[model samples]
Target: MTQELIRATIETLEMVTVSSLFSVLLGLPLGVLLVLSRPQGLRPRPALYRALDAIINVFRSLPFLVLMIMVFPLSRLITGRATGTTATIVPLAVAAIPFVARIMEQSLLEVDGGVLEAGLASGAKISQLVWTVLIPEALPALVNGVTITVINIIGNSAMAGAIGGGGLGDLAVRYGLYRREPVMLYTSVAVIIVLVQLVQWLGGYLERRLRRDGKVTASA
Candidate 1:
């Protein structure tokens, strides 16, 4: 039982890691694009911004389960299977990307307008302003948003298990539900709690470090 639990836990973490990483990798750029191209935002393009915003909203509005099923064909194309750890990553990452992107866009929006104005006044190019001023200024908020996204991903990983994606959640469904094993259910719950706590702690610590660095930079 212990060995099986350990293996399942590791597999769960691996799926979560892959899904979350891909989501971040894709979402960050999309978020940056959203912010930089909004009409009232940094770059301000009407048509392009509206189009992107619509796309983001569409994905965000869909339920995860529906989204997962909707993407099954694409998942099979990419992973060559509609079920398993690798197969689950496709939909998990797909569902997470827009969510993280929206969070990132909001974080970018929270940056002070005055700082952006100052950068503009100083003749910074759009790209330069984004890289040097906007992103750096919003780093703390961005980090927090990323933490939130990661936690969401962790929780959503369980949903992946429903589609035959192997993980702790799959174990729970198989043993706890099908076999009526209370031990498996309780064990999976405990592992999820530990994972969430660890993520929260790391996020808080990093947020503080970024804040401290921002303060030191402002002082200097």
Candidate 2:
């Protein structure tokens, strides 16, 4: 039981890490596009923004359980298996993409409009404006978003056990539920809670560090 719990913890971490990375990679760009396409955005295209917004909303609207099943075929096609730790990565990422995109959109939008205007006035390209001004300005908030996303991914990964996605959730189900081991169930829940607290602490630490560094840099 000890060994299995350890393994399950590792699997859960792997799934959460990989899925969050993919979410940021794809969702960050989508979010940038979403903001840029907004009516008051850098490039303002209402139609494009609306379309993108709708797509994100549709995906976000689906329950994670349903989304997991819905993506099984795609998972099979990509990972060559529809259920397991690795295969679960696909659905986790898909579920997180829209979520991360929205997080980034909100973070980026919070950047001071004056900064964006100044970048524009300085003849900076849109890419430059984003890379230099917007992202930097919103770095702390973006970190917060990432932290939230990581926690959410961790939670979803627990649910992934329903389909044999190997992790603490699966371990809990197999032994705790199936074998009727109350100890295993309670232990699994305790471990998950501990993991979440650790992640939350780490994220808060990073955000505070970033904010402090940004302040120092600006003052310098």
Candidate 3:
């Protein structure tokens, strides 16, 4: 049981971490594009914005369970198999991309409009404005958004396990549900809760640090 628990924990962490990283890598740029291409943005293109918006909405609307099944073929192509912790990263990342993109959009949008204007007025290029003003101002919000995404991924990873993705969820389904081992089920649930709480705490800590640093920078 201990070995099983350890293996499940490791798998769950790997799935969540890798998926979250890739999601951020892809989603941050996508979110930025969504924002910049929107009406009255850095480079307004109503058609492009609408297209991106629609695509993100479509993916976001799909339930993760359905999305997981839908992506099996792609996952197989990417990982050479559709089942396992590594292969699970494909579906998980696909689901998380739009999820994180929406969060990133909201976070970036929360930045003060005045700051963006100042950057523009100062002859800052769009990229410069984003890197220097928009992102810095939105850093705290972005951190919070990432925190939320990570927690969501943790939950999703478990669900992935339900379909043989392999994690705590797999253990729960295999032993707890299939073999009638209630203890394993309960233990898995507890572990997930603990992991979430720790993530939340760490996120809070980082946000506070960023806020404090921002204040210090401003004061100086």
User: What does each candidate score in C-alpha RMSD?
Assistant: 2.2, 1.9, 2.0
* Per-model lDDT: 0.88, 0.92, 0.91
Which is the better candidate, 1 or 3, if ranked by TM-score?
3
Please provide TM-scores, in order, for all candidate models, with all chains considered together.
Answer: 0.93, 0.95, 0.95
Candidate 2 Cα deviation (angstroms), residue 216: 4.9
Minimal lDDT window, size 10, model 1: 211-220
lDDT of each residue in 1-220, candidate 1, tens digit only: 9998898889889988998899989998888999988888867888998998999899999998899899999999999988888899999999999998899999999898998999999999999898899888888899898899888988888877866888888888888889999988899879988998999999988888888864554422
Q: Pick the lDDT winner.
A: 2
Looking at candidate 2, the ten consecutive residues that score lowest on lDDT are 211-220
Off by over 4 Å in 3: 213-220
Considering TM-score, where higher is better, how would the candidates rank from best to worst? 2, 3, 1
- TM-score of decoy 3: 0.95
Candidate 3, residues 60-157: lDDT per residue as tens digits? 99999999999999999999999999999999999999999999999999887888998899999999988888778888889999999999999999
What clash pairs does model 3 have? none
Candidate 3, poorest ten consecutive residues by summed lDDT: 211-220
Go through the candidates in order and give the clash count of each.
0, 0, 0
Judge candidate 1 against the unseen true structure and give its global Cα lDDT, from 0 to 1.
0.88
The model with the greater lDDT, 1 or 2, is: 2
